[model samples]
Target: MTVRISAPSGPFRDAGIEALREGLTRRGLLGCGAGAAGAVLLGAAGDARSQDAVQPHALAEFFQGHQVAGAALSPSGERVAVLLNIGEGGARRMAVDLIEAADPSGPRRRVPVGDFDVETLAWANEQRVMMRLVIPVTAGGNTPTGRGIANRTYELQSRRVVSMDLETGETALMFGDERVRMRESLNLGHIVDYLPDDPDHVLMAAREFSGLMALHRVNVNTGRADLVERGSQLTLDWSTINGVPVMRRDISTRGSVINIFVRPDGEGRWRRAWRQPTAQVALADFIWIGAAERAGHALVAARIEDEDVLAVRELNLDTLEYGPPMASRAGLDVSASLVDARGRYMAAAFYAPRLEYDFVDSDLGAHHRAMNGFFGNECNVVLANADAAHNRFIIRASGPRDAGSWYLYDKAARHFEYLGARTLLDTRRLAPAEAVQVATRDGASIEAYVTAPPGGAPGPVIALVHGGPESRDVLGWDRQAQVLAAQGWWVVQPQFRGSGGYGLAFASQGWKRWGDRMQEDVEDALAQIIRDRGLDAARVGIMGTSYGGYAALMGAVRRPDLYKAAISICGLGDLGDALAYERRDDESADGFVYDYWTSRIGDPRTDGDAIAAASPRLRAAEIACPVLLVHGVDDPIVQVHQSRGMNDALQAAGKPVEYVEVPGAGHADWEDDVEKDLMERYVALFSRAFA
Candidate 1:
């Protein structure tokens, strides 16, 4: 995929870059030569005239354009590193810029790197920033040969890690050896912790030849590493506190259980802290949040048997018992926790109708209130980072209608300065997503978000189910939902029964349910939305990606009258086929796949009847609504053959179906032109079906 980087046209075309450069130059921190930096800047700019020639301020502009993916504050809070997207469509690349915290206005030094795109950025110290680069790979060249373990067979682009000095613009690859690169390609070997006391090194977990992960103390300046601890064969995850690996999780297939082991002093044999049967794991176990301030104690999130939502609680490592509840919401799960640089628990955040943060630390609480009061309640203000003294903070403020902006707040000066928006967009034209509860046919209350057009009037409804059936629609800015709303469509994102962030009961209900209870939740939400908004049921359609795509196809087959059209993007059509493919490619132990499928999805051997019944390809004849199938030819998750199989089945069954295969696209990855084409096709298909 080739992304084009051309200068964008508009009044504010060079405003952001120029302002950043000027601010840094004025502060006497400009590192790169102006002439060389200018060339890079010019190359990063898009041809705004060309964009305008094709379409002026088209809805696609919102989808196109550069964006600030992430930012990090220096230890001294004197500077911030922002990761910015510099190109459009396939040619898009991520660039890191260092901006002065005092005056984040003009041109800043942009870190020079190779052709690889910046995936993530973090401040290693006051003067150094760590970067993760994503190296794109071709599908054909990276395809697995099916001879190795499933886990090892799957191909992935290499994620190279590097660190750079802000003052001198010097860079060094943290881990770029063949072994490190190979492990990274398989999603292993990552910087787990940055030892704050030792700025020269970071803790990383990398898989060895034994296929077991081991902790390594890696030098940041040189690609040197030292073994810290060898992980158990069954170790699935590990946690660290104060640069010490204190806890680790081991999965055992004996009874399909997960064992949590703890090493109080980070030495000697690991003692079992807790264990849960795999069948009861998702619903009954505690999710390790972080190591607590107090030794031999840790923070965890779990839902008590009597509780309807998950709550953050303190856990004693020695006794494996719960302490006191730190944070909880009546109908929502405590999604995340905030910890300070000193490892002190500060606050807990939950998402109900919207994201709400409850500060546990008094100082952080006061800061939260002050920032919210200053930014207004509409914005969800998050304290991203703070200085050692805790007087200066980097605050990220965003809402359903807002596209996120950064701010620097100084407690001593009682001053707050606006940094910049992640992306410049007209919020007035965007729609706000409202959380609503819908009752399922089985008497279950599922949470969902409704994004309607500017006016509150009812219009065409699109059931946009999120992927992962394991993932839920959070209260935030959803690009696709907003784009659809701009096209006069009410986008309904349902937090189906099996969706995550809703406690174990809700998510576990989705296992083995697939086309049954899972798809029912989508239909139930759409029905309730139509009734609540008085929307025309005949104008409603179903659409989703990944598992959501599967749900969309199943919806058309199960409830043809409810949806006039169905669009599946990179969706699974055959459960048995998908399971088989996973079994062949997964690198887990012999019985791991079987056990996981049995517990999460369903045993293909024992549940073959149910799997066949739910397979969209097998039930193509029952699909009465017009169907549009979109797939990425290089999709690593759900193979492109699934879409091909569904199309063939639909044609053989004499049903109306349209299939679009995107080349050089993996899973949900697509360029601007591909996205625009898909959007146009959606508009045409829905318009035709609704008409």
Candidate 2:
């Protein structure tokens, strides 16, 4: 979630920074020896008290509290469009509306896309759009799960392609597919994209049985499709090759490789155009923006890297020559738009780490005030390069306390006004966040945040570890972390090595060391905060979900002295079990998965000793702290037995362990009500144990 970021002004900004240092030093002293004195010392340093305003609420109530969706812009930069829904349907009902960009807050004209479901929507021109609509189908009898409904499927016969006139509010059916190929409990109509140059043609790839992908080109005019290619594993990317539109397949290789395929030159045949190197680079790391206005087949690509800014490169197909990066360092997170025939204006967005609204302007300097909201850093922009100066864009905005909304930014008015329904969130109430930095065991700097209950003395701190050992913690509104702090405990989120959003080198460093220095990163974060006296060293707790959960379990077993309590949610108990069970149908994806774990954790067969040492279940006996284990029974990703078996071991050893099972939930999407219940239980349990 996005957290509204501002350079804390007035006396609060300086005061906050000072308080953090004092709190840290006091906590550090307590960790060394002094206990009560350290707590008091830290308490005396803070100016603002933790607020106790947020009351417990139901998750369903929270879902109903807000509207969420994306806003789209017209190519001419005159009109802004957005998708909105009225009621809460599992499959959201969509309606596109157009509003005047000059008077953004004014009324809008609504255009209904369809009733069944808006599978995909793409702009055909400034006044027209292509949409894929599908009818939902359900099986006759109940499967075995809990709900009485049959498996739902997206039958080809149940889908129709239609074109809508934005200016006239008229719709026309382009094509209809009536083939019923596969029979699964639920059919997913995977609508990937529409041909960039032609609205009558759409590109779609579906996962057939046995994990093979069926790539098809559907003609909107004829409703007929031809299978261009089929592969056991293929990821497609689209772009212009030699001025001709083409499709590129990400095929199996060392890492990820792209093979460009061009349609037969005037002969109605297909041939390979150019292939990217296989070892180090992946075509997905960069997306083609638009070709230069010049005559040659020069294409522009947005190159993705460790840094936030998007790199622009000029690609020549005939000579296969690539130009140096342009538009580099556009204030960290820089998004760009291609200019039109006149080259009058180009739209772009730029952002930095300090916390502020994303700037979306033709000159890249406008729209700061409109973008700045609570957790504004969470806002993302999608630009439509429809002939350059005339462009359409979508902004998805959300934060910890607020659901996200989409806005349409039209260059004509120099404003991005609000569009329709937005994604609902549960961030009505939240706690203040304290940004701080700590040192790793090796003295390398680590960034972290410490947040506590409002109006409360510096209390117990929970080492809120993040998953993705490859993911980094950015400044934003975090519901889970804020909720813990509201419960009177200090929340600490550490960005350890292998965390992205930092740089490529740092993220890749965690490649093969999951529990070693990676664990040290978490430990150092906790130790530094304790040394600073921001939290009670004697009553510290460590908790994480997914990868974070794994870290919590490992932390408890490896160093119980620093953490008195541990919470693990959907954590992996056995590394070997994960590698074996985590295989997808694609062997290449699976191989990379296996390589990542085994190289970092240990190979069960080759490095049996290391795997056993790293697996939490095998080391459960070493954990002396109280542990809370939560798992979802229906989790398709992480097996539930990972938690059950570990809990049993702890129980057998006479250790304090509580196991909570979510009956019909998955790994991350636990039913909304279940999330609230879990939060309440965690808060009460931590308060009782720590306080």
Best by TM-score: 1
RMSD of candidates 1 onward, in order: 9.4, 10.1
Question: What would the per-residue lDDT of candidate 2 be over residues 591-688, giving only the tens digit for each residue?
Answer: 65556455555666787776677788888889988889999887655679899988998998888999999875777567445777887777766766
Candidate 2, backbone clash total: 44
Question: Candidate 1 residues 1-691, lDDT tens each?
Answer: 1111112334443643454433221221211111112211211222223222221124666665446667788767778887776766535666777888766555688865545666677887778888877675543334355575332232346666778887787786655555545543445367878777888888877777777778888887775778898896677767887888888888774435677887667787788866654434534446777777677778887665577677888777666677766788665677776665555566777765555678765665665655554332445677787676676777777665566766667676655555556665654445656788899998878888888775555788999998876667777767777777776779999988888777667778999999798888888898899998888887889899988899999999898878899999999999998888756654545555456666767887788999999999999999998899999998866789999999999999999999999976988898656888898898789889878
Model 1 lDDT on a 0 to 1 scale: 0.71
Candidate 2 differs from the real structure by a C-alpha RMSD in angstroms, to one decimal, of 10.1
Per-residue lDDT value at 141 in model 2: 49
